[model samples]
Target: MEGMAITRTDMLSVADTVAREKSIDREHVLEAMEQAIQKAGRSKYGHEHDIRATIDRRTGEISLARYIEVVDEIENEVTQMTLGEALSEKPDAKVGDFIVDELPPIEFGRIAAQTAKQVIVQKVREAERERQYEEFKDRVGEIVNGVVKRVEFGNVTLDLGRAEAVLRRDEIIPREHFKRGDRVRAYIYDVRREQRGPQIFLSRTHPQFMAKLFAQEVPEIYDGVIEIKKVARDPGSRAKIGVISQDSSIDPVGACVGMRGSRVQAVVTELQGEKIDIIPWSPEDATFTVNALAPAEVSKIVMDEESGKMEVVVPDDQLSLAIGRRGQNVRLASILTGWDIDIMTEEEESQKRQAEFNERSERFMEALDVDDVIARLLVTEGFTSVEEVGYVPVDELASIEGFDESVAEELRARARTFLETEAERLDTRRKELGVEDALAGLAGLTPAMLVALGEAEVKSIDDFADLAADELTDKEDGILKSFPIGEQEASDLIMDARVAAGWFSQEELDAMRAEAAAAAEAEAAEAAAEAAAAEGAEEA
Candidate 1:
């Protein structure tokens, strides 16, 4: 029987070969083989018995054993043994010791051999997948070249030597086609380990793909002399890259463009003739945005820093060029700069300015009962609203180019009268609309806003407190109609309404108010700090 026993030297050699071929650890292969053998051992013995197998690494000798746990009393006869029975095998057997019964080597049957082979194959495949995932997980965002294994429904599966990657249809460049055995290069955007295997996702249309191509073509970018700040792509149509140079002597845009545009042309050729814009980056958003809209000269840029928006003015002839066909140029610029860009012609800007002037002048004339010349002066002095004229320091109003103290006084008086009359009219309407007086008393809730809330069935302080900030301030449709209020203002109003409705105790409301005041102070301090930093940067 011992002479007929099989030696596992061949098994060890097979594990080594499989580990080498699959690029997995030799121990993983051996452990998988041990599990397979242990399963077979259990089947040959009894399913109720506790069977385990271990392979000697040096000799490839497999040892099969049945383990029984020593206990004071045996509950499971198959796995647990009484101390008396355990001590019969070993004199000093303890309660926790496992009594091992060495068993003869398993003889492989036809069905058992096939089952072991299946388990080994399954485990090796899993180990291969894990190895693939570990190898490629850190390699994401890198450009990889592979041969197309298959093309199924416009999706290409690339054979990446050891692993496979899927280039989805939407991730492929527009109109780009590949067939079996064709070489393809793509950016590894994602790598996910799934039950079947590691799924490597490739993309040719990602904005980073364009950036990586430039990094390959341009030595400066690869070596970090020129850093890519941002990238925006419209697939194969066009792309924009924002780059900044560390060395003052080197031109970032020129470095990326290369000699005679060779570097950019190489990238463009790979992208199926996609146009590339290499713009010099600036810390100043206005300068960066202007640079992003290259070739189309910008006459002026009016930026609203708070809104992250810029109104770019170009010459009338350059308007179409700045906007591009179907607004692709400006759209790409917006994406590149991370700002909302509104492009307008110089003529259009002038007309808009004139229209704003007329509107302000007319507002002042009506609100202050002033003549056209006085209204124009007030508008030119940056007073757009009667509220500003009414509440501003009298000395500030008098300091306007054409206004004296008496004129300022009279203008302010008229502005005050207009506001008082308007407020009285709105208050009367609010009363008629059945708005509660307590709701009107809430700060930031104007008579008009209260009337609008009343019309929306939010007539009480309770109703007002129950409304969300957006429910009152949403631009499209809200209780306040087209009235635009900031989130902080809405929050403050809601808290005041809640307090007025006796939703919280006075002490609780005071604590809440204190918290809000502290938040406001912190926010104001943050804003001031940012403003000072920006001013310092500007000065520097």
Candidate 2:
């Protein structure tokens, strides 16, 4: 008992030095030392024995002991004993009690000391890793300054003082190179706990990296007086940032450009001289898109809001400039404005519009049994299909230039007759295709769509119910591919078929729809709020 506990002031001093060096709590270092001593004690004694160790926080006194369980039946001779054996040692000993035997101070041999050192080093490294991860995880999305520790095959490893971050080759800007001991600035894009360790991924070419750089250089942006709506980067080549100022007196573009271009120049140098277009962000997609494609004039823009698509018509000579080198300008604008843009010259757009007009006129001439002159008049008045002529109000059709009420009624009658005849033909073809009646009863599947589904071998309700929305509406080869119905409507039709096939009860589907609608409402609200703060582009 006299020498069972040993005190060493040097132990406390070692813990203090290691804790300070590793930036870990001193108590954690002491705990690691206790584990090392426990392993040493277990090595000196039998390895199977239950050995425990502790160190007093104030005095650095180490205590080691072996515990044996007092039980009705002995499990092992080393760690367990029957109650009769324990009664001889202590009168108050009972079952489920642990009889601890204090161990004597262990003399550290070379092998034992080496094993203890390995344990201590491993535990300390683990503690250090936890500390680093906790400190850096929330630092993601912020720009960090670091020193280049090494460069391997163009991939850089930056030493961020307390942590290491990897800036992959793909994440580095073109023409940017780093050597060892060089100071570099990067954006912390992601932090993940990998199997090897906590990996912090950095990027120099990320769009937000440019935005963050501007935020650092421009005071208005940092203070939230000027808002950066969107940023698109072609890294080391060019970029466009859309900005909107909350205050009318402050022009966002002018503020970002700064006095004498000082603020913008600072960012430009950091980005390796990537040309930037600080455009004004407009809530109108076409206007903003026009601004995004600067240094080139746009003649016209046509937008299809439902499809989020745009066609931009530029003068034939300005096409190259608007498209930029390798279509980079338009691509960046598309990314900035969130639209898929198709650029065309005025001649091409005019020719395309003429072709559409001719197609509609021919369709009207055939469907209404009218001459080319009358068909052209109807097409000029915005009639595209027989269905439109059939359903439009007779008075509205009569109000068209040079058309009387009797002529309008006769034209609409011919359109309805043609549509009825087409429907009969489609129904007959659907029947000929072996499409089932149960599938015909499903809403949103027209006679034409049913024929297509039948040709694709999805005739029965069960067959239709098993298909996904993409299979029903895929633009490439979906059964209803020719129809204008979107994926959501296709899914609803398929869901209805599922209900008909008894795959799901109506009540369950209703509940699911209610939940989905709620989620969609929330998502739409968030998207609208974001859109209000952003811009969109492209139309011809």
Candidate 3:
């Protein structure tokens, strides 16, 4: 019986043991013990009694009592008492003060002891889970090594010493197999605390995983002398890494490749023989893109900044290498460079140029009433449109190798006549369709575009404003129907139409947003003040 009696010191020792074993706070364990004691006290006393327990942190003293709050009026006899009754017990008792009645210690029986143990175990488990969540939540994006604990339905569960993580099937490299007890290295991409436990999701196929592997092998990269600008991978097959050296003396690519390719080979072996292309990054987009499609020579690159696309012209023999097996090289390059790439051989480019030249020549001959030879000469001079010929200074046109001042003047006069005739024709058609003058004044909208809008019943500025940008410029189906326009032009035109329609100006919208922000700040201040007042009253 003496051995079975649990002393107050034993209670604190047990809490310390549980806290140490579960990796939870000792105070949390003590609080759980206090709750268990209060439950037992309530069971021994009347179930309706408001019993509470507190453990002294320094001395491990257990105190049990029934607490009644002193109020202006008695509400429930079990938990609340009038100020008069509270004053009888304590002469200086006031409203809002607690009146406590001490209770005797509880002797735990078999069932009571089991209940307390269960409560402590539950609380310790909850605290452990919280600790795990907090520990790993910020550790996301770190590389972790673990033993494969189990494999279920293609998903691998890794036991990472203190925590367990899941490597989902899709996140695993394609065709890569893992079995129980096998070691695995993965990147912690996400950590979510769910109802059951913390879900630490890991991935080996993520691009960052390869980046981390390189960082591990390359001391220069790890030391911040070399920066990994971007990484793109077709997991288990091929990858492209863009690196830039901050120090001119260090070669970022050489550092990552290591001696005799040992460093990159180590990464490749881990990735199941995936081929890696190390590209020297450049701030110049064209140079960077050319380097990204390595082992394939690029003859010329035409970039369209607004469209986020690049046209790469390679020699006919190098076309296959540039495109890669199933377009993998260019695909990875596009991902690394953030540009859509269109590959073409020199022959194809020449053919396209000739076709464009013929088209321009025919248009010049028809519009300017010139002979085929003269039109071809104009086309060869890089004049693609009549508008360019009309707008360019006569001296610039005369600078063309075969042209004189007289010929340049004749071409300019003919271009102006053709443009004026075309404008008159389009203006007559626009008037026939009742196109609004304001719509005609908007930039990027041709006279023909205005007629198309009028024909589609979008004549008024309000009507144009009501139309979506896609409806105005989408290639396949738009209000312009067959006329193609870029998305940026469409957006600009739509905004212009909106402004013309007397919608809110940019400055007005900014002022309104500022006003709303001020109101929200005031409301939050009021809420904080109220919360502080409520806390003060509770303390009183």
Best of the candidates, lDDT: 2
Best candidate (score: TM-score):
2
Predicted structure 1, TM vs. truth? 0.81
lDDT of 2 at 149: 95
lDDT of 2 at 67: 94
Candidate 1: tens digits of C-alpha lDDT, residues 1-540: 222445678878998999999999999999999998898899989889999999999999999999999988878988998989888899999999999999988888877887788899999988889999999999999999999999999999999999999999999998899999999999999999887899999999999998898889999887777889999999989888999987899999888888898888899999999988888889999899889998899989998765466999999999989999899999999999998899999889999999999999998888887789999988888887888999899999999887899988998899999999999999998899898887888777777777788788888889888988888766577666456576667877887777788888768978978998999999999999986886577456
**Which pairs of residues have clashing backbones in candidate 3?**
none
Provide the lDDT at 345 for model 2: 95
The residue ranges of model 2 lying beyond 4 angstroms of the native Cα positions read 1-7, 69-97, 393-395, 398-413, 420-442, 447-482, 487-540
Model 3 per-residue lDDT tens digits across residues 1-540: 221535779889989998988788999899899888788778879778899989888888888999989999777888998988888899999998998999887778777777777887777778888999999999998999999999999999999988899999999999899988999999999999899889999999999999999989998877777889999999999999999998899988999999999999999999999999999999999999999989999999988886677999999999999999999999999999999899999999899878989999999999989999989988887787899998899899899887889988998999999999999999999988888888888777899788888888888888888888788766566877565566757876776677778896867656765898899999999999986886577456
Clashes of 2: 7
lDDT of 1 at 46: 87
TM-score of each: 0.81, 0.84, 0.77
**What TM-score should be assigned to candidate 2?**
0.84
Error of 3 at 123 (Å): 2.5
The clash numbers for all candidates, in the given order, read 0, 7, 0
Measured on C-alpha atoms, candidate 2 has an lDDT of 0.90
Q: What's model 3's lDDT at 353? A: 78
Sorting all predicted structures by TM-score, with the top scorer first, yields 2, 1, 3
